[model samples]
Target: MPTYSRFLKEILSGKRDCDVKKMINLTENCSAIILNQMPPKLKDRGSFSIPCAIKTLEIGNALCDLGASVSLMPYSVFTKLEIGDLVPTNITLQLADRSVKYPIGKVEDVPLRVGKFIIPVDFVVLDIDEDAHVPIILGRSFFATAGAIIDVKQGVITLKVGNDSLTFDLTNTMHYPSSPSENCFFVDSLDPLVHDMHEHLLISNDPLDLAILNREGLGNLGVEVAKYKEQ
Candidate 1:
C-alpha cells in the first residue's frame, strides 16, 4: 500500500507505477485534503458562489465553472423572465454527467443584474432537471468578460472589470465525495521553473520563472523531448 506522501511523490515524478485501484484507495482514504473528512460546517468555506437576477426573479447561486465552455440557463429561469426572445436553434447538447441529448433552443441575450452591475449575457437555454443545486452555470464566457480569478482552494472569487474589483462569498459550496476510484489523476500544468529537479514535471532550473502551458498538446512532442534532454 502506498502512503499519501509516496503517492504524492509518484504523481510529481509522473510515475504511474502503482496499480490504478490501490493508488486511488490511498488518495481517497488517507489524503489530508479529502473532502469527506472535513467538518460539515467547513463544507461551504471554499466555494465561488454568487447571486444573479433577471428582472424580479432571483437566479440561484451561480456556479462559476471555468471548465465549461458555454453558460447554461435552466428552463426554470427562462420561465420566470418577463421577456425572453428564444431564437430558433438546431443545437444539440451533451451535458457532462449524462449521454442523453438535450434539445437546445436559441440563445437569449439575458440582462443579468448582478449586485450593482447590469451585465447582458448570452445564455444557452436548456432544461437542466438533472442538476439539483445549480440553477445557473457561469462558464468561460463570464470569466472572460468579468476577468474572474476563481481560486477554489482559498474560496475566493476576485472579479476584475477594468479598474474596478468585486468579491463574493460562496454559499452552498461544492463538496468532494470520497470517490478516489472515480477521479484519480489530474492534468499537468506548466509553471515557471524555480528549481531544477529530477522529476519530468520540470526539465531543469531555468533563469526564467515562467513556462508556457501545454495547450497545443502532443503536436510538438519531439521539440519538447529535445528541450527536456537539453535541460
Candidate 2:
C-alpha cells in the first residue's frame, strides 16, 4: 500500500494499541521516516546535554575571535559593541544541527559551564538566536573556532579537534531569544534624486561617472539644457 494511503487509513481509524517492538520495526521500515532522518529535514529542536561548559566574552562590544588570524564578524554587528567593557559571561549556548568538524579557541572573562562544573573562560562571546522552537543557529565564528556540530534529534553536541569529533548530549533544556530589537536603516536625505543616484553609484562598477557628474554640478538642469539645445 502507498505510504499516504496507510497514513490516511491510520488517521481515519484512530489510535490503536500496537506491540512496541513491531511498531519500532515498522517505523524503521517507513521510507518517509528514513528520509526525514536526513540532515536537512531532521528537526532536532530544543537543547541537548553538553559535556563542556559554554563560554562567553564581550570584546569591546564587537564580536572578535579570541586569537589573531581568526575570522571577524561583519562590520554591521561589530560596530554596535563597545571596546574593553567586560561583556556578560557565562551564557548558555545551543549547537548547530550538522555534524562537521572545525577549530577551537579560548577567550577571557566568559562564563563557562560544563556539566556541573562552571568555570570562567577568557573568550569572545558568540551570538546565537534560539527564538524558534527548533533553533537553527550556532554562530559560524564560534563553529569555525571550536569545530562543533549539534545533533538535536540525537540529543548530542559534537566537538571536533585535531581529526577527532567528540559528542555530548546536554541535559534537556529550553532555549529562548534574548529580546526583540527594531532594526532600522536611517537615511539622512529624503530627496528621490539623491537616493536614486546613491543606489546607481553603489551598484555601478564605474562610479567615477556619477562622481564626475556630481562634482561638475551638472544636475537635472544639464539634462534640461541639453534637451533645449537639441530642440
| Highest TM-score model number | 1
Best by lDDT: 1
- Lowest lDDT sum, 10 consecutive residues, model 1, at 207-216
Each prediction's whole-model lDDT (CA) = 0.64, 0.42
Per-residue error at 12 for model 1, in Å?
Answer: 44
Query: Which lDDT tens digits does candidate 1 get at residues 154-185?
Result: 56777787677887755345554224455657
lDDT of 2 by residue, 1-231 (tens): 998788778776875444446444455547656577634566545433233323232221122122323232222222243323434434433324443323232234334343333333344334433222321122344445456576556665666656656665443443433244533457465698888977776665443544444533656546545554565
TM-score quality measure for candidate 1 = 0.50
Q: Over 4 Å off in model 1, which ranges?
A: 1-47, 130-132, 175-231
Q: What's the lDDT of the predicted structure labeled candidate 1?
A: 0.64
